[model samples]
Target: MSNDAPVSTTHAPQAGTHEVILEMRGITKEFPGVKALSDVDMTVRRGEIHAICGENGAGKSTLMKVLSGVHPTGSYSGEILWNGESAHFSTIRDSEHAGIVIIHQELALIPEMSIAENIFLGNEQTHRGAIDWVLTQRKAAELLERVGLSEDPMTKVKDIGVGKQQLVEIAKALSKDVKLLILDEPTAALNESDSQHLLQIMDGLRRRGVTCIMISHKLNEIEQISDAITIIRDGRSIETLRVREDGVDENRIIRGMVGRDLESRFPDHTPEIGEVFFEVRNWRVQHPVRADRLVVKNSSFFVRRGEIVGFAGLMGAGRTELMRSIFGRSYGNVLGGQIIKDGKELHLKHVRDAIDAGLAYVTEDRKSLGLNLLDDIKRTTVSAKLSRITDGLVVNEAEEFRYAEMYRKDLRTKTPTVEEGVAKLSGGNQQKVVLAKWLFTEPDLLILDEPTRGIDVGAKFEIYGIIQRLASQGKGVIVVSSELPELLGLSDRIYTIFEGTITGCLDKDEADQESLMRLMTNTTTRPETPAAS
Candidate 1:
């Protein structure tokens, strides 16, 4: 965006030139019961894109926190060298003052403020002790254009979607005159087009002499954009590989991160579909914002008892809307629909009704709608079915603790105790808590929306196993995932949706990535099966 190409920087010393902007030596950070980081060493070349790869809970974020002064200097034993000199930052403000900016996974934008105001929050343009609205709007507009966002600068932050908000965050960082930029899973919430756009923006920034340190689990994106890849595992630096070099493979990078060859990204499961257990007819849902527009058109599908049904679609393909509408009519306007459970029509007017009718929906966005962060594991596990612990009018503490403890062990949740706060747990563990909450309900049908998202491979396998076990226990399971491989591997039957319609349905023996992609992209039309004579 700055119209200046990045200056090529060398990693090691060559002749009389030394090429290093930032270097962290012997970094060690410890928590109460965990050694988050230990003897980690890393170096960043000026204007180079350096990628940090690791499994969840491998201390990648912890290392970045230390660099950004979130952990402070005295808490960690490390020497941060900037421009060939030792630097100690006491706070985030101190690091920012030194031309270092970090964009966290959870964006730090004020929802109530306009885009222009958010970009120039602490660093506003003032003229004669008064705010310069015209200058601020112009600068914000230029920054937005630079980042490939076409949204109005005066638009409220809450009105725009997550992807647009991400671009705004980057623009805000540019406003700070950042020299070293850190992005933590910036593309986690972006769709395909938006993700590609963000990656290109990062490339443009690199070309404009901006040094970047990206932490991401998206292996494909990491391999494509990174100049060098560093793998960390169990709080230790494994190895750093130059991706530009020959014979550097993704498998090798994954091995370095997880310490093993990932035999299969998705676990093996043979589904034995029985009689149809859940069915929907003439389902139509209106858009949440535009009541006149339909997000999910007249769609109908069914899942059998002991079957794993998969829904595959792109970002705006109406897969989530259909599920949410059926769950409780919780999402948008339901123009017309009838849900039949076990061959009987059931009322699903609200979340309570849906739950009572033997249905449960595990939301894709776990942070906001799924779990209660402020409550403990014991509380959240039983939150959905408080009646289980309620004796007459009051909840029995002993019964609640017993149920929570059972789930803690049964689900293999990684926590010190059941009383621990859900906020303190890892992403995978939090997902398990959400699963535990629904499993307590003992529903006949379980709808999992992106259940394994933002978690490690090991945790995904565990979730897959859970799904298979649920199907084996005669509970119908419906899984929605953007990852094609996951859908093909786990589902007994898959339904492809595009533009608010079910494009195709394939049995386990008939589905593959190519076929699914064809259906997803609307390239091939699905054949209709004749009704039973």
Candidate 2:
């Protein structure tokens, strides 16, 4: 089928009356024990940047899946109207043929392939059944430029970063002559500048008559760019707001999604800072892939026994690399560093050494690094300290289950049972499981990397409480977060990193969002007076 050709069964929303480009009426989707979407109704106008927002499991992604044909037409009860007519798409290709393209949160580009090859993968230009390499590269360059990407088209996808990869995905959609674009969390992993660039690109596309639907948790971005905002909660549409209308408040949008006014996004806490317990000195790390390049440069910091230390920086600022390298050299090549626990120097040559040294690093990407998805909660809980449940090489299942159940209640993890697979739990619950795993290890120093990322407001509050509780128990906690408000709200001490160097340090009393942002952006000048003085 021609990529640009409209599907025979696809109907476009009527052209006149502002052109309803897409309509989903009476959409109902059900899974075992879960009604994901219930008689959902949605309408999209032509060339508008429509934002679909909700808490996790709020049917935002499910509705997009239904539209993109990830859930085939027969699987859900719905009528899809496009360009003023009815449409039934049995497959993604069928929808794409009708100029509908979706870019999922998890990208689908082949890492080994070049950007040009990935963009024109399925619909490559061919002459006499042979791929037209020259034409393909030229067209790919044009598409890349359209998406504000200046990378060489021939560069392998693996060599580029996530922001560029997202742009490449957009370029691939443009190559398919996409008229309706659905982006699921396009800027979730992107830094502020990259996210802003992506939003600008979306605006550019809208001006070019491409209708866009974006799913995002970032309310600020939505408020800034969306022409319309639709809030869905519990598989139902709560309300839709026109940004151009008078008195459109962010609180109203949040209340619609959450069913309550979130007076504060962060929970209140009083940090009880104790004596210094964990300290890193003269820390340095080389890039894992490029051994010659230094990623973390002489980073030195300390967390007190009953304090939460916040690490703030832009993406690739070496925050995560510093934590990981100090944890056990789990990330980059350790060039030089000294970690001291209670005035005793410890060797962290390996992960086991770090663990034995009472150090635990909870990864930012928990799905791939922190938890074993296929394993049960009990198994995951004891994975970090199998020896605790082991009796002469034999694992004590009862002991493991008992510890898991205790932690489940302690952490307030919302799981049906400890026997349930960690994969079946919500993002917040999965994070709890990861925390439980490390807590079981009885670590003195805890490194939490984006511990509350992708969780709901309620879950975030609970997590904040947990962090405070950990500090209260004399555990030194270090948190790395992209959200500056989170760092300012939860931290006793804040350290700002910029381009692999620690640029500024501030106590909770002095670290406001604006000041932190200044330090994080590396715009603040160093004071002549000593910080201690």
Candidate 3:
């Protein structure tokens, strides 16, 4: 069988007397001013992989929270039936005790702790009120093996890559003796190979009779691994399709989740290329801790006016470091580099200097660096450029409100009002707010790292439209993304980075997945585009 084909031998779910292991009846979840889910009904057969499909705010995560006790009992109106018995869970521990464990898109592992410690965190191996060290290590090793991870149990979680950390989370779940495994957007941060491995592990779990429920926006993956798919549209359960060898396709899933046919995943726009407006020469950055060793080698690239240039590379390929070092020394110490804007060499010594020079960077980590969850929308919108709403010595609150309202409407940020705290908004809306924050800066150049990461397809299209609009306004755009298809679809020109160096550059017509991957891995004969400035 092909690698893309399903590993399951049985195309259908349990045929005979298998019981329904889980039933969520009349589930309605509500937040402050939003009704997330409405009277949703879902059932999962024993030992089958079930998938939930929806748009960004369609309440897939909220429904999973309700089931896993993140919402707890008395929080949402719902009836959870497990093994034909009504189950009321008041905490995550209650759900775990019942053999249901969930791994969210954001990993929950403590970074400083070792794999063994993280695995047996809450449920330690004990004897007569004393922890058993040998037993703990042995069991942690076994669970890690089950998840196809080769790392030592003594290794810390922070030292591992996200793909390996994903496996560690599964090992942690295995330590709980999970009978039902729930994964939310598990492969969003993973590459194609890592994603394939994760899918294989899910299939392995199904063969061992573990019921799995997955929520994902990747329609192809849903069509492949799932035995049944439940489509949620605007907080309503639309329909469930039972998978057969030839019964399902990507278009069907897209149409169901989006409530209409999405003919293209990206908005159409033609590039109006102009002279190179942004250029970096001989960029070299030293590692933050090990100053002797360089993290970004002699790299050079350029972006033209009204162009979307893409940086394609693997994890830790120095893309983020390069961008950060260029933007006001937010990262490592720059050993040598010249940043040129228009026709002038820029000497940006700090973040303030970079911002004043009309440069803005939207970091890849939105939670930690992009948005302040505690601040209100109005404040966040005017944060980067307070001068716009400030008087000579005092601040004008009405002007701030008006400015925030205008950008909120322009970006189509979905919130109750500009007074709504950013902590209450969804992932897509939070991303929009971040963009609004940078747009207020009136930047001539915008740097976006993983712009659409962890968002839904509909939200991705909206963001693409925003990028195209920005380009239309003659602002230079640089996009760094791990998703090759995203880079291929959006970029007017693409540069591949490997081991902190520029390996190859391809124009839009010459770039594809194979060429990009070859250059990314340094498999090309020589860089098609010159690296020397």
Best by TM-score: 3
Candidate 2 residue lDDT tens string, 347-425 = 8889999998888888876766798789999899999989988999999989999999999998777665898888766
Clashing pairs in 2: 11-82, 12-82, 12-83, 12-84, 12-85, 13-82, 13-83, 13-84, 14-84
What would the TM-scores of all predictions be?
A: 0.86, 0.86, 0.90
Model 3's TM-score against the true structure = 0.90
Model 1: per-residue Cα lDDT at residue 359? 92
RMSD of 1: 4.4
Better of 1 and 2 by TM-score: 1
lDDT of each: 0.82, 0.81, 0.83
Residue 184, candidate 1: alpha-carbon lDDT: 86
Tens-digit lDDT track for model 3 on 1-533? 11233344354444431678999999998877888889999999888899998877788888898999999999989799998899999999999999999987667888899999999998889988998988989999998877667778988886565657778887888777788999988776665555666788888778778899998877777787888899888888999888773487888888888878889988999888778888999899998756777878988898888999999887667888899899999888899989999889999999989999999998876666788889999999889889877889777999889988998888777777999998777666787888889988989899998887667777788889989888988999999887888999999999988878888899999889988878887834354554223
TM-score of 1: 0.86
lDDT of 2 at 242: 78
Specify the highest-lDDT model's number. 3
The 10-residue segment of model 2 with minimum total lDDT is 1-10
What lDDT does candidate 3 reach at residue 308?
96
Model 2 stretches astray by more than 4 angstroms:
1-17, 112-117, 123-168, 376-378, 396-436, 523-533
Candidate 1: how many backbone clashes?
1
